[model samples]
Target chain A: MPLKSVYKLYQDMETEQSIISYKGVVSADLLTSVLNIMEDKLAIIEESVSIRKKVYNVLVECLQNLYHHNEGKGTFTKNAKQSISSDKASILIISKPADFYEIKTGNFIENQKVEKLKSKINHINNLDKEGLRDLYVSILNDGEYSNKGTAGLGLIDIARKSNKKIEYEFKPINDQYSFYCLNVKIN
Target chain B: MENINLEGTAKTPSVSFEYDNGTIELRGRSIPENSVEFYRPLNEWLKEYSTCPQPKTIFEVKLEYFNTSSSKCLLDLFKLLESIPKDKTSVYIHWYFEKDDGDIEEAGEDYQAIVPLPFKMIEVDEI
Candidate 1:
């Protein structure tokens, strides 16, 4: 496997029409900074309130999931060949295409948890709009719903806001963990 | 019990509770690192407020954004306020959002559907 050069990653992002691309440790402080920058960028772009709200809302959920699920295991670096090690690693990109803005996130998860994560994504993808809403409400009201420091409403909320199927792919990085990528389209 | 009034930050919303006037307001962005921790005190305050419930209480929430964790915490706050007897206290939730933001309006509706309160969706020109 060839290593991804930092410059090539920039060029690819340029071709993909992405703005505000970050790949590294995702701390709470980073979330705030990224949100401020995203808000400024969104304001300059002059999108409708509904679209802006959707993007912002989805971004929040994505950042939360990234922060919560990041096990500090997978190397959180733009280029794995680099020796930089930042704990709590993840990737976030906001791209604007012709029709809609796409928010893509990449992170690492333990191999043991891959099956559960895949099943959750599959369940969310299979749900209709109404099903998503019901799930969101159900989890919200259930006081006992607790796992890995989340109410499990992040995915449901993301699916609900996107109004589309949540796209996700998993790749085996090693025998221990895999790289999980999620794609959310906001039109 | 003293009312809880704290300023907002870039990640957390500002909290204001006026026991005298019966007004509880949370405005600004809400995506705190630990929402349960951030909202625990407010929930405790509401529990104490129910002891000497206000006659007419108004809960105003004007948030620009909130993550899933904060969403659950907000629901907890609302549920606490909802526990106050309706006969003793008339509660109204003023959920404000940008006029063009259907997402915020619907978020408010989600809360309205779950909680038994008179939810007023206020449309504002700006967030």
Candidate 2:
């Protein structure tokens, strides 16, 4: 990571009206505390019941997705070599941009998975409301669980609740790994 | 039949299935890390309840927050209720949400549409 790019990232976050941002290992216990803290923060800022719920719901999905698939931390993809140097780590930023709250999450992933993930996200972004809802129903009933016993519903749930398209970028860190970043918005 | 009462924690819901009252209420937030493990016992209890369900079993769900994993467990619970012969056990799921919380109402509708039963949406001041 270059100094200029890091500085640019900092400036971007600074202007996005960030409520909170965190980096490092994402554990189950950490998720519990983060959710509690953010719940209180959301209650104080938003008076509309629906917006608060939408933001909160989307936040949970984002955090859970990080906890489930972040490179070496989660018990997904048994064949991939264990990554070193903050590969288990993920970043979370809750920001208020314009009329919507953006939950931005970044985590390291095996480079080979970039195309698969990009396709999945782009497929979700292209869906109409009805398509998303129908997809949610089928995914829920599909009974497919990851090795960690997660139902793989985190991303779909985020897309269903989020009224806006999910934005993302896959920045290659090395030949072996890349940083998968996603920005989901709620109105 | 015996009652199934479990206290809520920071990451789990409070469950109270009183056999005497024929009422089952699930309240509070449910965001357990391993939701499948946390909800397995409840599903087993529901299995037992199915064998000897009351004439009229009423489920009152007043959850403020729950994860997608817990969401699946809830659907499983509703599906179990749908299995019991209506003539033997008339099950009614009352989904309570705080007023102005359209998201919860939408969640309830999602469950209502899937489960064939008299699932009512009730608004409250708070849970």
Candidate 3:
């Protein structure tokens, strides 16, 4: 896989602790594999259950976001190797910092939607835990009764767990597409 | 009602609930692929248990991990436990965490703050 080369590129960066990295097309199977790797690594850490759960939850939300917002045009067929268009491919990196785990995911987003996402993350980062919980409950109930999907609870969950501000950036790829980078620090 | 027993997976947890003794155990990881589907039966069973509860119900939650959706479901489960009459039914929650994991310990404390029930946070060795 061409993606293997991407992994090879990161192998040369000699760091104090091992840096586990994987670059691949975002799919359910790939998501599960990544979670398995993370769980295996986290198991060795004492008192990691809560952190493990938070990590798992955050990854799920990230993958689901990719799936829901995938800009790919072709339908995926069984038994057929569906090539992910360069614009549709998403990259996720989980790196262990000295004091925290840094989870970063980048994907193509429409140039127009970048501002909305940035503003949303900013707003969520400002709320306290109680406020976030109240917002979550309100959204859940409102979405359920109104039949609205994607109530933006994933961002709220991320904010609640990370307990830190979300750092993100948008790099313009072209007129129509921009690369969206989302970074969360779990301390 | 029938019992609910299932093993845990990398993204999900194991559940073993006996209707006779009302002892329910949730162990292992819990990050279900589809939180809605994974928790449907557990929620239904809890609904049933509410109507016909055992005298003493012991809930052991030894989860290494769970997603946000599962956290909501867990709160629901504890809320159900809080509903039972204190005299007719006694509920004991054993929240197990690894000794070094501060996150799990804090989670147990957070739940205790929310639910009005007898919940104990116990630190255990690696499973």
Candidate 4:
């Protein structure tokens, strides 16, 4: 791959209105730093306390989901070739493109898991605001935790809090893996 | 039973459970990476406290923010509180949210609906 010029990278960020963008392994320490940076940034750009809280809440769910779901170093597809970079490395970009702010995250997942995740998000997207709230409460009351200590409420909570449809796409990395990309909009 | 007084951190909340006074308090952000692990001690403490709880138990939660995992763990915590026999200890919950923080306020209302405990919603300048 040719190395992109620094100027071009800067221009890309500017064009996208990206305030913070990172592509690497997601870690606990990194989650803290990212949240802190966004907190400072949101404090300045957003004035309403309710909206700020909504954005911050959605951010916590998105970053924590990435931290938990990241598949550690493995084979990933880049340019249709088997490339072994930190396959666990994910991408996060926070931008304000228009009236709303967008949080975009991409991570690698086993191809087998794609169908279930797709169904889950589609189910959430179909729900109205009231349905989303009921689902969140029901899951919370169910009191089940995955091995990673998640309650499976992240996406629902994100949707309920943001009041927006979550945008997503899955690109096949290989037969073994696919990249799961999620975009959440907060106004 | 003894008291649990834990300091708050960037990812977890500060917990104070006074066995004698029956004041159970949790204050701070609760975005722990492993919320189940972080809350295990409190769950155990509540289990023990339930055996001979104080006459009037007051549970207080003043969280600035929490992730979805923490939210479930909190429900688990409340379930434990609900299990305490009312005859032994009259339980009351004080749920605090910062003014204008509609998300937190609504979260408190949601818990109040499902937890089966008398909850007093308190709006404060900050928590």
Write down the C-alpha DockQ for each prediction.
Answer: 0.73, 0.67, 0.25, 0.89
Q: What lDDT does the true structure give each of the candidates?
A: 0.84, 0.84, 0.72, 0.90
**If ranked by DockQ, best first, what sequence of candidates would result?**
4, 1, 2, 3
Clashes of each: 0, 0, 4, 0
Model 4 quality (TM-score): 0.96
* Native-to-model Cα distance after best TM-score fit, residue A60 in candidate 1, in Å: 1.0
Q: Candidate 4 residues B1-127, lDDT tens each?
A: 7789999998899999999899999999999889989999999999999999989999999999999988988898899989988899999999999988888998998898899999999999989
The CA lDDT at A52 in model 2 is: 86
For model 2, name the residue pairs that clash.
none
Q: A29-91 in candidate 1: lDDT tens per residue?
A: 898899899889889894586788788889988998898888645344445575434356789
Q: Classify candidate 3 by CAPRI docking class.
A: acceptable
Tell me chain A's TM-score in each of the predictions.
0.86, 0.84, 0.79, 0.93
Q: Could you tell me every candidate's TM-score relative to the true structure? A: 0.91, 0.88, 0.73, 0.96
Candidate 2, residue B55: Cα displacement in angstroms equals 1.0
What lDDT tens digits, residue by residue, belong to model 4 across residues A1-187? 3466877888988988998999998899999999899899999998888888898889999999899998746654466555657557999999998888999999988889999999999999999988998888888887588888899999999999999999999988667778899999999
For lDDT, candidate 1 versus 4, the one ahead is 4
Q: Which stretch of 10 consecutive residues in model 3 chain B shows the poorest summed lDDT?
A: B64-73
Candidate 3 scores a C-alpha RMSD against the true structure in Å of 5.7
Candidate 4: segments with Cα more than 4 A from true spot: A1-4, A76-86
Q: Candidate 1, residues B3-122: lDDT per residue as tens digits?
A: 888999988889999899999999998887678788888988888888898899999999978888888988988888888888889989999998877777888988988998899999
Specify the highest-lDDT model's number: 4
Per-residue lDDT of candidate 2, residues A85-176 (tens digit): 65588999899978779899999888999999899888988998888877777777666666775777777778888867889999987676
